[model samples]
Target: MLRDSVTAASADRAARGRAARKRVPRSAHGTWIPAADRPDPVGLLQAQGRDRLPELLPVRYARMAASPLAFLRGGAAVMAADLAAQPHTGLTVQLCGDAHLLNFGLYAAPERPLLFDLNDFDETFPGPFEWDVKRLAASVAVAARENGHKEEHVFGAARAAAGQYREAVRRLARQGELTVWYQHIDADLLLPLVRSGRRRRRTEATLTRARRRTSLQALGKLTETVGGRRRIIHDPPLLEPAGAMDTASLRKIFSDYRSTLPEERRLLLDRYRFVDAARKVVGVGSVGVRCFIVLLSGRDADDPLFLQIKQAGPSVLEEHLPSGPYVHPGRRVVAGQRLMQAAGDAFLGWTTGPEGRAFYWRQLHDMKASADVAGMSPGELRAYARLCGTALARAHARSGDRVAIAAYLGGADTFERAVGDFALRYTERNADDHAALGAAVVAGVVPAAPGV
Candidate 1:
């Protein structure tokens, strides 16, 4: 069976290569995934996340099964599986496979500039652009439903997301590379859009809050002194303080990781000297995985930089992607993240943990935050959608075929309509899944988390 799978994958790669060569505008291999024969979205997610589902908060689990639409929206791996089964236009890159309403956010670029890009790369891989769009649109539809919008209103939001994506991609193609790079979604452009009749006062308030979100705030929350000692304290079953790890065991792991780093980075990091590290649970999907936040203090007390070393599992995008020479999943994530984000963390790096687990390291809380969906108005939603769309397009353009994609999209109308259709259909699917989850919770099939 393994041999057969390998052979089939090899054949697919060859076919994709040929197809890419024949196209009017050249593109990466296997970039497009036709919508006709996608996978059963729900089943795909269940399969990929089976081992970790029990570890998720029951409230989150309930929300996943709250409705078919909700389930479909949350089950990105499932969608990727389905998309992988279809024919595609063959534009490929390291995609943020689970791009959704909440995934877009603000971050510090390398030059200390604040920029926006896809914040999550857990599912990053070379995949079809449409798959990302479909997922994002569906998320809008489900999120709208979560906000109490009716079906028609939900579809309207999805349509709006699609329209924005179509227009934004084309617009970037016409701009100079430097101009596109310098461009950012600031508060000024959005205030008028929201203040006008198109948005609500409440939504404007949310954007106002998002604009204020920064890494400094994260540092304040995540960094604290414990028991008269300045340190990041442990929040049990979640954020475990470093003092919890067995020193002998950690020293062994750190020694191994040191070998993996380049000589210069290793030397630079060595100056801080390892105080301690802890196993932490982080993010919705990443909980229960082995995540460690290493605290390294240099000469001064304020010179402390916390680095989160998170385990890298197989890409949620693995099934759809053509295998390459990447030996470490962590490396794949780090590389893809650097390519996709306009500016990345200066300390971005990767290493293996004890037991050979792939892990990516980054400064914890270097001003990371997200948009609050519940606080957004209809107008704010639309403006945020445009921001995410343009960012997604730019990320893809950097790694894939911008010229071909732009030519195929031509103008936003046709593609937008197609995406709108898929989004509406998928949103219905999410509602169904969400409802199923609720049923499961009621039946005690899955325990419910407190928040729901």
Candidate 2:
């Protein structure tokens, strides 16, 4: 009976996909326009700032004003609004909701292999799969422009990425369900896939750096020995000690978080006791959100475990996209991440703060690193874009109807060409939005802590 039900559901989904293509033809995806009632981009950003740390909001604006690509990274909410206005097939998936190029990276799996997958899920939720693809393609185009690549190269990168995504989804759709669920692109497997010598070397270098970024390495870099006791060092606005009330609340929250973990993981966590914690600013888009690095110690001074407890607000897509079943924002992120990633952090869990804020916790630095796209040559950037697209396809296939999505994409280059054109157009829109933000900063309408 269960088997019949599952098969029936799959067939229904495939039918829906076919019907969606009829409703919104694949070629029509190239068109994009702001809605007549589209909200102001600056106004949307300011709305987000209301919930963030007041002091660090300037840093967020400055980061966004750095470049067009930088602006795109911080403008996920703005893009979500635009994407909501665009035509969609109504196929929902566990989107990395902010699926920019920089969000894909390398992290250590349980067996210690460096695996490449989506690393950030701050904006993750169930949304139209095409929104994620469009964001990725636009990011590629914007980043290419930032790197001074030719227009042809920019569009070529976007096209290649879209093609890779379409082809990958098709390939995964044909595989066994178990195989698709277990598939992961490890660094070793990824290196051979890079045809360019420069890209291969860059991949190797990134892997080397990722391997060295363990919890112990982070302990050395972020903490210090003061009067025979280990404590998180203060580094001005970027990293500083949490307030007494905040620390107390976090300790209580950690207790609640431990209950959500597996028994074995909880047991492993029992060996360590909370020692200290500090507020640490991180990432271009996450500067103002309350992020903390907590220190835990075992039996000896050398034994250490660092955990990051970050505030998880509503996903950027929550307002614009159809809502899911999640009530806790942190749980939404944790669930979406586990559903998308092949292997997730063993300690991934969520808790609610005393003030009703949702927060998620994970290892501070467990062998993680992102490729430096700015330094990549045009050829290398194109290759990297392809890998990101393939990774995104794999993630989407995990929770969405892969066969249906692949069928809508079809064997022709219609979807690829449309998305590529959309990417180029969106890049121009992003540049104008960025310039507006810069002018706002200059006019003193928006506070900015430039270069911080």
Candidate 3:
């Protein structure tokens, strides 16, 4: 009876996927037109910062105004509102919410292979799967243009990402549950893709750098001996020591966060005594949030571990989509990360921070790495785009009806082509929005601190 029930449910889901195409045809996905009453992009960005620290707001504005690509990275709220106004195929999935090209990267876990997957989850929520696909495509287009690629190359890169997303989703649809669940993109997969000698060496070097990005490696760069003991160095506006009050707050929250972890991880965590901590700035979108780095030592001074405690806010997609399972913002981020990543972090957890704000804890850098999109050649960018697309499709399969999405996408390139068209059109608006932020800075409407 259980097996019969499961099969019947899947059949109905597949039928629902196919039925969605009638209401919003796959061809409709290619179009992008701004609504008459679209909210002011700058106003949307400012509204998201209502709860953020006032001091670091300038840094966020500066980083976002640096370039069009940077604007796209930080403008998730603006993009979310725009996409909500568009017609979408109703195949819902747990979206990364901000699935830009850079967000998909190499993530390393203890004792497991280095797998590439979506690493950022601040805006993760369940919504139409195509929203993520469109965002990814738009990011590729913007990056390609910034890299000075011609029109043909730009379209090619965008189409490549969308095409791979469609194909990967279709392949997963044909797979059984465990197969899709267990699937991971091993770092070794990158080796075969780069056939040329020079590119191979570059790729190898990048991988080598990632392997060395552990907490032990960070000891020298982020800290120094101060009066015969290691302490986090003060870098002013970016990295500063969490003073007495913040330090005490962190200590009190430690026990609450520790209980959220698994028993084994909690035991392992107990071995390391907290030594020093600092307030650190991170990411374009996450700049003004309360993010802190903790230093822990184990066995001896040589052994070290770094953990990041980042404040969590409501997802940018929350207003447009139905309410999700998690009521707490921090728990939502941790849960979404666990569901999407093939092999999730053992130390990931969430808890309430000072003033009842939500925050999540995770290992700072377990050998993480992201691609250098600014330097990629056109061919390399296209290949990287396709790989990112494949990885995203794999993540979606874990939380959505894969068979239904595949049926809606069909066995054709129509979806990909349409998305490519949409990406090109969308980037035009992104350019104007980016300019608007810069113009606001010039007009003194909002203060900015450049080159941070």
Which structure among the candidates has the greatest lDDT? 3
- Candidate 2, clashing residue pairs? none
Query: How accurate locally is residue 217 in candidate 1, as Cα lDDT from 0 to 100?
Result: 46
Over 286-319, each residue of candidate 2 has an lDDT whose tens digit, in order, gives 8899999899988776778889999999998988
Q: Write the per-residue lDDT of candidate 3 for residues 369-443, one digit (tens) a residue.
A: 887788678888899999999999999999998999998988889889999999999899999999999999999
Alpha carbon RMSD to native, model 3? 1.5
Query: Order the candidates by TM-score, highest first — what do you get?
Result: 3, 2, 1
- What's the true lDDT of residue 124 in model 2? 93
Off by over 4 Å in 3: 1-10
Provide the overall lDDT of each model, using Cα atoms, as 2-decimal numbers. 0.64, 0.89, 0.91
Candidate 2 scores a C-alpha RMSD against the true structure in Å of 2.0
lDDT, candidate 1, at 416: 66
Runs with alpha carbons beyond 4 Å of true place in candidate 2: 1-13, 193-202
Q: Over all chains combined, what TM-score does candidate 3 have?
A: 0.97
